[model samples]
Target: MSIKALVAHGSTNGSTAQIAERIGEVLREHGLDTEVRPAAQVGDVAPYDVVVIGGAVYAGRWHRDARRFARRNADQLSRKAVWLFSSGPLDASAAQRSIPPVAGARRAMAHLDAVEHRTFGGCLREGAKGRIARSLITSGRGGDFRDFDSVTAWAERIATQSLGARAEPERGDLRT
Candidate 1:
């Protein structure tokens, strides 16, 4: 059967939602049936063979709804292929830094056997904040730090790994 993948996200400023949409787009190009939706709009994950969950981080924590989803569906998620992502860091350097998930998310993910957990750079307007906060995040360049190339590559990798199943096996199909 073809893999059914869901890219669900929780975003406040829309950056993380855009990333989720990008991932879903690439997955669709690679032939997996993909759906991108906000976490609050999603219901049961049992129908999907793979799940990609993501959220935005604020104050050293993931969005509350995303964490709740991860915790509430822990069992169903553990039974399927899961990948997690976060988008919070704004500048290029901050994007490259190794920032792990927050405490609550870590607790929820402890048993997920996830394929990977990625953190992508976020985008913020240079003058969105006050003088000091703006200076810290948007000193040099602050349009968008998200890397579409990297995101596409990762989605392609996932498609290759999870999208090879046949809806109906041929008589002698070794893959089946």
Candidate 2:
């Protein structure tokens, strides 16, 4: 049977949603049937063989919908091959860019034994954010920081494991 995967994400300003769509597209290219949906729109996991959950980080927290999804689906996810990602961090340096998943996300995934957790560079566009975000950008702390190649590579890695082509190593972090 072909593997069915869900790429669910919580994004404000649409950047993380785009990231999730690209991930779903990549997995589809690799032969997995994929669904890309906003986390709030997803309330069940029974139809999927694996799950990819991603959320945008803001003020050191994941979007509420994503956290809620993780918490609500923790049990089902625990039995499935799961990969989690956080689209945050604007820096390009490997060390500087590697931010851990938010606390709620980490806590929710603790019981799932997820296959991997990845942090990717994020994009911050002018006028896309609210007062504080716009202020931060105006201060030169943000811009388009997402890296497509790295995102694709990580999706390929997930595809590798989800397809059962190779055994995944002990849970690791993909810092892009």
Candidate 3:
């Protein structure tokens, strides 16, 4: 059976969504069937063999949509290979060092038994929605801080791990 992966993210100003899409792309490049969707739009997790969930952080809290998705699909997620990510630091901090998951993401990671969690730099540019986003842009504190290379490296690591592990047959399988 082919492995199917889902990359679902909760992005407020679309930066996190782009990161999620890039992850899906990397997974697909490694031969896994992958789908990228907004967390709120994903109705179920049963179709995927593995799942990668991410959200944009705001004031140290993860996006609500991501939290809801994890809660709603906790049971299914716990049974599968799961990974989590956060994108919210509008600076180089995320790329320079490991940024831990925010409070909500940490809770979900425990509940879902996720294999790993990553934090990526965030982006904010002109025309971004939300007052805070606008303020940050005006205050010269906003820009595209996302590191696509780091994102790609992380996804490649996931593909390598997943592909290697999945190549091994289960204990009970008998071959002629």
Best by TM-score: 3
List, residue by residue over 19-79, the lDDT tens digit for candidate 3: 9999999999999999999999999889887799999998899999999999999988888
**Candidate 2 wrongly placed segments (more than 4 Å):** 94-97, 165-176
Specify the poorest-scoring 10-residue window by lDDT in model 1.
167-176
Ranking by lDDT: 3, 2, 1
TM-scores, all models, native as reference: 0.80, 0.88, 0.95
Q: Residue-wise lDDT of candidate 2 within 1-176, one digit each (tens)? A: 67788999999888899999999999999999899999999978988877999998888888787888888888888877788888777667423555677787787668778877888877787887678778778889887778888889999988877765323345332211
TM-score of 1: 0.80
Clashing pairs in 1: none
Clashes of 3: 0
Q: Report lDDT (Cα) of residue 161, candidate 1.
A: 65
| Candidate 1: stretches off by over 4 Å | 94-98, 126-142, 164-176
RMSD of each: 4.6, 4.5, 3.4
Stretch of 10 with least lDDT, candidate 2? 167-176
Q: On a 0 to 1 TM-score scale, where does candidate 3 land against the true structure?
A: 0.95
For each candidate, what is the lDDT?
0.76, 0.81, 0.90
The candidate maximizing lDDT is 3
lDDT for model 1: 0.76
